[model samples]
Target chain A: MRAYLLARLGWAVPIVIAILIINFLIIHLVPGDPIQALVGDFPTPPGYAEQIRKEYGLDQPLLTQLWLYLVNLAGGNLGFSFANRQPVLPLILDRARFTLLLMLPALTCAAVLGVVLALAAAPRAGSLYDSSVTAISLIGFSVPIFWLGQILIIAFAIKLRWLPAQGMISLRETLTGWAAVADVLWHLVLPGFSVTIYYIAVVARVARASVLDALSQDFVLTAKAKGLSGRYVLWRHVLPNALIPVATVIGYNFGYSLTGAILVETVFAWPGIGNLFIASIGNRDYPVLQGIFLLTAVAVVLANVVTDMLYAVLDPRVRGSYGKNA
Target chain B: MAVQPGNILEIDALSVTYRVRGKTVRAMNAASLTVRDGEAVGLVGESGSGKSTLARVSLGLIPRKIARIESGRILIAGRDATRFSETEWESLRGDPVAMVFQDPLTYLNPVMRVGPQIAESVRRHTPELPLDQRVEELLELVKLPSVVTRAYPHELSGGMRQRALLAVALGCRPRLLIADEPTTALDVTTQAEILALLKDLRRRLGMAMLLISHDLGIVASACERIYVMYAGHTIEWGGAGAVFQTPAHPYTVGLLRAAHAVRNAEGRFATIAGDPPNLAELPPGCPFVPRCSHALAECSRDMPERFDARSGDPHSVRCWLYEKPGLGFDRAGTG
Candidate 1:
């Protein structure tokens, strides 16, 4: 456990550093001036433009700006948004829960549904189930998320009246507790389902392919010969091996899903980091953009770190295989 | 109720065909045999010799993706298994007959602990027991120290895994056990130990077995009767004692000679000529004719029937050499 933890910590160092570098570069090198935005038409006004720039530390050297950003970042002060003057951390925290609440369940649902479909389709590779799933996934992969979201909104929300078309639940409703929680879930259906469809499609395809490969392995045959039920053979023998390939995609997809969640959020006008990110990018809000990007990079790295720890937990060969190889 | 010393499992006209290269390949063709209670019947053959197919078909573990049983009767305890539903097959598994596959490592689920895996099989048979007791009993049955069950497949040695598989197979108190090359993957010492353990288990449980292996010495030492298969055909069948003492079929003789223990290095390998015929493009007559040293024009033109090898019961060869046909010993088309 200690070794695993240490290894994860070691892997995180480079990612954390890369995020710092990329965050600084993206925020620093961008056109237009935050100082100018802060004080409109102050540019070319001698001593006036200089004063606002000095006040915001925009007059500071590139290295100094980076140093300030890094120091404040370590201390949990993500600086203030240039356009809104709101603390970046507060803005992010206010929106983070909503994004997580939406994405977490969507992710879980996608994973479970994908696994079920994949397992069902595994035994019938190239048959109707396989072709149908493959075709569905192809359509899914090709669909523009914004278009898909709009289609869902029209079908489920406007035409059918099965769901609320827009707006997250109010704070007052959520504060009323568990009943409000149920209300949020009911409201969550459209956006969640919209996000999940893509995940389900991709994960299902991956899982089906992996399990098909696993079934052809000698070990799966060995498990069947042990008199294990076909279900047992699938759940115990095939799925575990299948999940190895699945785990790899899960780590990478966490990033893809997190960033991609923005497009859906924008379509539904849902309040998430993605929506916040798009708003930031449109206005060229430097602090908010930097904060969200940094957080996302960190989240992806963290997901990978956790996945690394799960390696030893899932596969003993991975746990000790490298040691033998070394 | 003790098992009477006869007829435990029967395979009648068991034929398994697989599609290969846009053509149907007969993996096993009209293969018939029986393993009597408390007896060991060795299905001996080289790779792709229908031996493994017979084992799988009899167990209902056929690979439905490619392989299909054309027409056959696999009767476990005089009951036709072809008609069993999935649920019925599940209920019958590990209870009436249990199968242990070739590779030991592949037998145990890598993700599962040894004890729990065995306990699962045990619980399948007797699901009412406390899990702890069931686990302990399985560990004892397999003769492993109880602590070994806590270990995963990667943790246990290959031999230990085999023993655990044996325990799982024995869990339901099966009337018959099918072991397909139990010791093939193990080292010499481990192989001997597994062989001995299997022999002991058979004697103690009085469970009949269809021991599927290509190794003649292993069969000669462990099994009582041996059924020799070639290109999906059972070319020779008889008691192991009689077959080894006087191998009837040329393929059987070649296999016996090919075995490392029977033929020492100084004596050059008496390899059978030509490759075993591809079942898809098998010769018009006997499947083994392409490789048989005794093959004649008649052998290629017509299939042979079972005939006496040494004028004894329980010893038969499917070769015209022993029949009152147009050919006699050291002669061409003249008896």
Candidate 2:
């Protein structure tokens, strides 16, 4: 098992490097010039542009710039954000904490809710509860995340006044300790729900289908024939088997959740990596963009590796194959 | 005092039907059989002949929503069990009766260790007993290695998986065991070994068995009485020796001939002409009439009733040919 995990992690090294190169290329190739965006429509004096470009090493050939970037990366430096005027690593990390605070809870809640609803609905595949869950999931999956976030704000924040409309916390409050935490959580309500609702639908549908498939397996009959109760058979034999596929779905969606968070964070003005990502894009903050891209890619790859490990833990057949390969 | 039935299972004229895409399928038209205490019985038939369905019905394993019992009575341990609820059926299963299904690779949970799969029943049936020791003992009873308990189903060979499944059934400490095509997925040598194991276990445990198989030879070697089904009907049944030697129904005769040809290493082994009738749209009378070479005018008009082919013998057949014993004997050229 240890060998198998090491092999997977090893394979991820080249993939992360490839993503770093691609992120750099895509950012450079875009039509907008960081210098022009930085100066912001002001008539640039003749030598000001060249001086700034040379100062940041952008005056060098693309290949040379790429080499320097790679060298700096090896030395554990993400360079300075042109607009933020700070080390990009710390800037990205500071924003990442807030993103994680929102995303971790949203994803965990989505997965838990999805599994619970799937368990309830799969057993009664054609009942009213099943139909209602199906309908709710379909609606949640279909509606655009941005639109949904806005609507949630309008409903809870504008109409009912039940939640704060935007931002990570109330600026007026000088709260500390748990009070500060509570205020942040209160502000988190809208964006978190918007991000989580869509994923809940995604996870629940996948999990429901997986549970149904597990229920149809021959072992379920064997379990039932052993005089095990239906509930016991479901919980023991069905749920673990069903969760294997759902784990894959969750891991595959981790990247998409980052994209979803960008929109939700933007709409709510949450001070997360997603909001930082948008601001960096507008300002063409190359160092921060590269940092965020590299971090996101590495995170996604790690998520998949963790999922594979979970599969080994859940299924003996998978563990055996991994052992053989090792 | 009321007299209790001596049989461990009695399925009397049971008919089970399934609904599929707006059509009702008669999976079991009127099948009947019994397993007396400590006796092994074989139910042999072609695919879709309802042999497996009969086994499921006996165990009350078929889901009520998918299939309904049209008419019949099932008495388990002399108790009227036709009206048994799901809870009653659950309690009855793994105690008075347990089943080993076909394709052990599919039947045994792939993710579960062999030990826990067996202990699932042992723990339920005998909670006070030491589970680990009982699992080991059950494995030993099936002649599997004690170390096999730690392995998953896929790690084991086909024969080993079947043995593991048998151990699981035996863990229930059942009075009766229903093995539905238990050896079908195994190789020929493994098939013989499993049949032998089943026969030995039945003797040692004093447990009655209903061994379902399409292979007549496999059944003949393990069971005392044999029931022959075709198109969801029990056409011929008697002592295994008598039934094999003097199969009364033409369908039974055809099956025996087919089985015999294969056993003799005959290339291009004989198969009965025509396929079994679709239960959704069966012809009037006997379902086998279209395939029966000896089909008579009355055979297509209406279904025949069961008759004793020989006086003072339990051997019986459900065929118009059996309406007159001498006539059926003359046609089959057997006695």
Among these predictions, the greatest DockQ belongs to: 2
Global Cα lDDT for candidate 2: 0.87
Off by over 4 Å in 1: A39-46, A156-162, A169-187, A217-219, A226-228, A316-326, B1-5, B128-131, B260-268, B311-313, B325-327, B330-335
Give lDDT tens digits, candidate 1, residues A1-326: 56666777798988888877877886767787766666676337568878767877878888898889889999999988877678999998788778888888888888888888899888788898789988997787678888888998899888998887776774553356787777778778888888888888878889999999888877666555556788888888789878877776776777555566888888887888888998887677777888888888888888887777677677876666556322
**Per-model TM-score versus the true fold:** 0.91, 0.96
Q: Rate the local accuracy (lDDT) of all candidates.
A: 0.78, 0.87
Every model's DockQ, to 2 decimals? Answer: 0.52, 0.81
Model 2 spans > 4 angstroms off: A324-326, B1-4, B262-269, B329-335
Which lDDT value does model 2 have at A310?
84
Give the docking tier of candidate 2. high
> Which has the greatest lDDT?
2
